[model samples]
Target: MDNDPQAQTLIARFNKMKEKYEEVERFGRYHPDYSTIMKEVRVSKREMDMHETIAAYKIKETELQSFLDEISQIVAYSVSDKIMVPMDGALFKDGGCGCGSGGGCGCQAS
Candidate 1:
């Protein structure tokens, strides 16, 4: 909702991907030769691999978007004080440095 250009771009991309998926679904459902076309398609190994890669990326993009949406909701709730626990310091024990027993870089739990 903010005037962030990156967010706007991501939203646009997501919308375009959704439209493309709908179009593909419609085509597969209505086209008489849809199965035949898929069976007869003669793609090289590289092309097939790229297609798989693109599909995987599309799925990951959707998952990442969902995660971001969840995170945004959590942040909104936190800002509104709907969440009781303070997320910042609630992860550690005794408010001490979070270094583990090894105590190297304070990156681990003690």
Candidate 2:
């Protein structure tokens, strides 16, 4: 992507959101206090959603809708496949790794 200041700023915001979302997801997975941790996760998800909406608005206003839309689709597909689907499977199944990495460090196995 070009080094446009607005695009750079919006990309930084999205990166921050992705990091925060991953942190909350990790906490929700491994925290000892499940109930409290999930509450925090829910709050964080809502905040991320609000930020995404605002970012969409900013992109639209600046005529960066196509750029943002393409990036958003990639991010959404990745998050859905890597995080959401695995989380749902873990909740429903026996909580095994779905990536088939054979218990490697990729799955954070000790």
Kindly report which residue stretches of model 2 are placed more than 4 angstroms away from their true locations once superposed: 29-110
Off by over 4 Å in 1: 1-50, 81-110
Q: Candidate 1's error at 66, in angstroms?
A: 0.5
Per-residue alpha-carbon lDDT of candidate 1 for residues 30-65, written as tens digits (9 for 90 to 100) = 777555444333222224325544446657876786
Number of clashes in every candidate structure?
0, 0
Q: Who wins the TM-score comparison?
A: 1
Question: Per-residue error at 25 for model 1, in Å?
Answer: 23
Question: What's every prediction's RMSD, in angstroms?
Answer: 14.1, 13.9
Best by lDDT: 2
The worst-scoring run of ten residues by lDDT in candidate 2 lies at 83-92
Cα miss at 18, model 2 (Å)? 0.8
